[model samples]
Target: MDAPDTAPGTPQAESLEVLYQSPGLPRWRLPPALAALYGSDLGFTEPCLYANFVASLDGVVALGPEYRHSGSTISGREPADRFTMGLLRACADAVVIGAGTLRASPRHHWTPQHVHPSGAADFAELRRRRGRAADPELVVVTARGALPADHPALQTGALVITTATVAAHLRSSLPASCTILAAGQGPALSMREVLDAVHNRGHRVLLTEGGPYLVGQFIAGGLLDELFLTTAPVLAGRIDAARPGLIAGQEFLPALRHPASLASVRRHASYLFLRYQFHRSITDASDILP
Candidate 1:
């Protein structure tokens, strides 16, 4: 691969080493620097819902609730991983997260520049070429409406989706930039309803950074289309039931199986970036599971 035609004064890092990429993946126009750093251009199907996560070699995505910023810890803040995250955020119309994720990541801003600043200009350029806003809108999903009102990300502005009761309460306290949408009435909102609301807002390409439980909802609802996982070369041994893998709040081992096709693979030193495409139509497990 050739060196990226990075712009002047752009901070440079080791580009992602592409090990394998399946043919026929969608391609988008990326700035030269981004294309070079990412090892290729990236794109997504419109109305697509995708997820991103960094897990330990032992498949631990979170280190229980005692640790803060588990993803950064798990990935060791690998530049290539951050670059991939920024690239994905740059490609989306909205970045969605669950309330638990928001609470866990108190200081995070789900923006392309926030995760990977070196490619700020290039990310902005890509968004412009794709006709997106200066920054992808942030969407937070909450079933109970529990959220930190003063969280910086919330202060920065986000679309908060919750039940009617929660919406009524959050609308009064959250920042003026936040929009509260009432989607359902219950302990949990259906992932389908959440995606429908997001789509209605004209977000064709959605990126979910929600936690395992939320991702499980998407998987259970068959809403997620793809997943980008970065496997850090570290083992987070599971002690009891605290450590959770990529999915939580649901099980799909013996009774049901949802397989993913390898779409691409890249390497950044010890970290391995893997892209997977889910092809099966996985509906509610409640209907299929006994």
Candidate 2:
């Protein structure tokens, strides 16, 4: 599919068409002015975790060997997608990403303004109104403490969640501005422990921009509450072994399938934005049967 015109000022002022929305779900649409979309309407009373990703029409999240940042290949740096990512970051108290994701985007700063510069002022206003920090705290999960220490995001100071062994290893390597949270005793970090640590810091709205494997851990632990997925019209046919789908390195058995309810859908030219809310009972790990 051909990409829509992404001229400097046109996309930020265009409204996305709402082709279909689930019944009783919010009827919100992306405003032309890039004003806060669904501002403060989420009503998240406690720590709620949500993830966002862009994938090809055939469900491939990454294009192997072609792009360093897989998401860029899928979305092709679409303006609407960037705006939506910014809006989600504006609503979040923290933006969680894996060490691999941080390594992929060397220049990315997990802030709303960084992705959507046109809506910088609006994003700041939203944060101010919500009484959030100047920028969402960057939460980087790494079990082995292996990270790109010189990356820009790390230089900006982030919360590195990892195992105790990794924390000790990172103490002398990571930037002084970075803080470490030992979420596990050994090599593996538990998703539940990471969420507890995040919640302890008073972050109620958490947003994750994952690199598939990390997302798989959240799914396995039943910690993912919602997902915001952008389906680009193009097909990225992947025959390589390295390419991955939305969820990787994990599989749900037939009896353990976790179904998600369609929350909303919006269209921008040929692209489709989808919001899916997973069943609460299934997402709570304690409620799941072995």
Candidate 3:
């Protein structure tokens, strides 16, 4: 090339900033109607759900026995990951997960039993300001159909998703209050089928808070649409073998498929938070995530 056009004396910060950005990553934002589907609870008629999770720098989504339960002090909370999850549920038709996940992180029901939930009490006013609704359906997806209906989470009436095989394996005395949707010939319901079922229910905007296996299944099956991953400044570690947390051997960016393009980043405490849309052929594909 010829002599450099911009030198130390030149201000090419804007030009150089563009180079650091990824190809499929969203650079210019979508108008409110398009990309705003996540934050706003109303726009989605069947908009794929928002699945949020936080991990240490090592990408360890979970640690110890509690799944995604890294002391609420991590990126997820301190910033209200619990409430964020609750709000997501508040707007969801269902919350989804796998059989193994239920045995792992396992939500014992934190929301109130009333289905309408008293109109968000505090969050309803805030949601109205953002042009989204404060109401949603609550559900749980598991393979074993083991979440006791008497548990606080399910006691409130969130439906449960599982498989025919798993249901057969479930405790015979399982509570009748639990609405279980049995899946294919196998114990685990295919992710695709679950999404379709939720769509029919009118969640429109779904949110999936996950354990590692569920996250892996979504990525491997290519259904991940938008990812909200929070990276804490520390590492979970490499010595432990069994409790390796979410996506241990799983891939975050599959080379063969479309890349996970960055949508935005925010800072919390000492952590870095990012939102990325699954860039490429699968943003709204029904089989994956429409």
Candidate 4:
């Protein structure tokens, strides 16, 4: 959705621009909802309920190992993207992920000191702002129970929502802090069920860092509130390949009186980031927020 325009000459609005203009640390830029979080006037909840993520021109997600495939050592470019990816970690009360994604790019809720500059990563403070007294929760959905017990992410604890009918042996090996939340065995824990659980725990702004299938399901289910898309200048040339686009099956944007709306398309050098708010109530992806 298009965020309300910031008033002219205000430091609040400036923070939004300064963050976007900053060259490095992709996760450091402030989100448009920042003002609402700190400002009054709007009731209590974030003005909107949503989730967003950054993907390559080819739609490659950077949640884990594939990030290296996109070139991490490219000097100035990678840091901004990395920071942008990590920044989402701070935005959500709980981060939702698929088992395939977690196994592929295992992550910790808090970026450890060794992973980031000594004083930069603050998991404790971010959670407090969300009204969470402890570390952010990790929601991992798996059809089959296969998460490893020794993965570094366990130290802070996690909620494993699976449909395998039983918990894995890893549950026994892990610390007593972990909890396995069973959400049936169908689509496993339905997206609605998971969101309801997290929302009750004080998270109104949930961010879904996708692994394609998961993104596709949310889009198909009409559960996606908004999307933050960053388009880089370079092209990966997948147009002729005939590979699947977005989701594999047959969900397409329908034609509507106002089918699609473009919120804000901002240019930073050669690249442009465009946000589209899906009006799924009409069952149309084209109906973006103008």
Residue 255, candidate 1: C-alpha displacement in angstroms: 1.3
CA displacement after TM-score superposition, residue 210 of candidate 4 (Å) = 2.6
Off-target runs (Cα >4 Å) in candidate 4 are 1-49, 58-77, 107-130, 133-135, 168-170, 173-175, 185-187, 238-245, 248-250, 253-261, 282-290
Q: For this target, which candidate reaches the highest lDDT against the unseen true structure?
A: 1
What TM-score does each of the candidates earn?
0.93, 0.88, 0.66, 0.64
Candidates 3 and 4 compared: the better one by lDDT is 3
True-vs-predicted CA distance for residue 157, candidate 4, Å: 1.6
lDDT of 2 by residue, 1-290 (tens): 11112235534524556666565643323343554333213334345788898989998887663467677667878878887887888888999988777777777789887777788887787777778888999999888677988988899899998888879989899999999989888656778888899989899899999678887888877788889899998888856467788877776776578889887788777988888988655553431111
lDDT tens digits, residue span 76-177, model 1: 666777778888889999998988888777777888887777778999999999898999999999887789999988998899988777788898999998
How much does candidate 1 score in TM-score? 0.93
Highest TM-score, which number? Answer: 1
Candidate 4 per-residue lDDT, tens place, 1-290, comes to: 10111123322111122223212211322333432221211111242334444444665334233343232222124223333334444555666666655555444343312122321334344545546545346666665666766556655677776643655544665567677765555534465565666666666766665455666666655666666665555534443443333443335545422233454454444445555566656543421111
Q: Which residue pairs show backbone clashes in model 2? A: none
Runs in model 1 lying further than 4 Å from the true structure: 1-12, 286-290
Cα RMSD to the true fold for all candidates: 4.8, 4.4, 12.1, 9.4
Task: Report, for every candidate in turn, its global Cα lDDT versus the true structure.
Answer: 0.82, 0.75, 0.48, 0.46
Question: How far is 176's C-alpha from truth in model 4 (Å)?
Answer: 3.1
Give Cα distance to truth, residue 140, candidate 2, Å. Answer: 0.3
